[model samples]
Target: MSTPAPPFSGFPAGALSFYAELEEHNSRDWWLAHKDAYERDVHEPMLALLDGLEDEFGEARMFRPNRDVRFSADKSPYKTHQGALVGSGTVLGYYVQVSADGLRAGGGFRAASSAQTARFRAAVDAPASGLALEQVLQSLRRGRFEVLGERVKTAPRGYAADHPRIETLRHKELMVVRDFGAPDWLSTRRALTKVRDTWRSVRPLVEWLSQHVDSDAATT
Candidate 1:
């Protein structure tokens, strides 16, 4: 039996200004200066939420906030957002990305150090992985998906070209599993309930895909 999701009541506070502050300063120096507030007000609460989730799901993990930005030219010292997971092992926990808009849920199950983002992109494009991809797309199609950031112009798969969520999809790497439609204001209890409900709905499809993939692998 899957564990019940944590209560939504435990969600972090002051997330909007935290994101705004990061964007406004947009530099390592500024983050360093404001590090205490960021950790106390933003990181700690997020970690607590993750801890609650981990207690329920048995495998969610939070990545350390110290980002490795040495290879990139952008040089932003801190992540503009935060995240956590609810599953275990190589298959990452159901992932969540928190920004000024709210909390969004999706998968972030990648293993490679160098090509993690690329693999996610490929997964979205892969016909075999389309089941997971389609679940999300269908939600967006039904207008159930919410855009957390500023609205944009492009539509998702089912919507017309001018659909608002399109812009959010365009800004982020759409293939990455960070597009789940959770709202930040949702209480942790409610969020957990929704997660369980969603997982129940999708589990059969996920299992079918797993079996199919295994059979194909054996044949190959």
Candidate 2:
């Protein structure tokens, strides 16, 4: 039999401090100087956390520490934070990000493709699914999750300006986020508990998106 993964003891104290300093000195020279700290404090703990989560949440993928500055004016060489996507893909998954500010957990579709956007609107325009989505959002809000998205200033072109669900109709990309915000629990095993619970609370949003927005429309 295989050995069970060790319990996540939590991120080292240096993890936050390293990112704190990285934000101030986000350059290759500084990163090369502190490569060991990055590994010992930041990278390793992330791997452990992901390992602990994998059995129940599926596989996880970590974002590179290197910044993709190809199209950006800000030429910083390293990220001020670390983030990962949990689960298989954008269809239905979770996201976690840690930075100097603290940890955040999220789920749901960040942006819908054109076909997905069409399906999403169609479902929202349908009373039953629209009410179902609203109930899910309400439940998340009560659990302290924030619902956000890129949205048009007014209703989309085809939707009426005064439509009952016009506000939701304006969203171009829909997602949910929960920020732990520098809590003391962040340095304890409870951090994993917190993240797990947050993901649970947001799962309904992921399900809604999969059923109403993506599933069939995604293939075409």
TM-score of 1: 0.55
RMSD of each predicted structure: 9.3, 3.3
Clashes of each: 10, 0
Cα lDDT tens digits for candidate 1, 35-135:
78777656666665666555545555565555677788877666777766554343433556666666666542333232433343344445556455556
lDDT of 2 by residue, 51-160 (tens): 87777787887878898888899999888988887743534468888888888898876553677677888888899999899899888888888878788898898999
Question: What is residue 122's positional error in candidate 2, in angstroms?
Answer: 2.6
Question: For candidate 2, what is the lDDT?
Answer: 0.79
Per-candidate TM equals: 0.55, 0.87
Which portions of model 2 miss their true places by more than 4 Å? 1-6, 88-92, 215-220
Residue pairs clashing, model 2: none
Worst ten in a row by lDDT for model 2: 211-220
The per-residue C-alpha lDDT of model 1 at residue 160 equals: 49
Q: Note the residue pairs that clash in candidate 1.
A: 7-188, 7-189, 8-187, 8-188, 8-189, 9-188, 9-189, 87-93, 105-180, 154-166
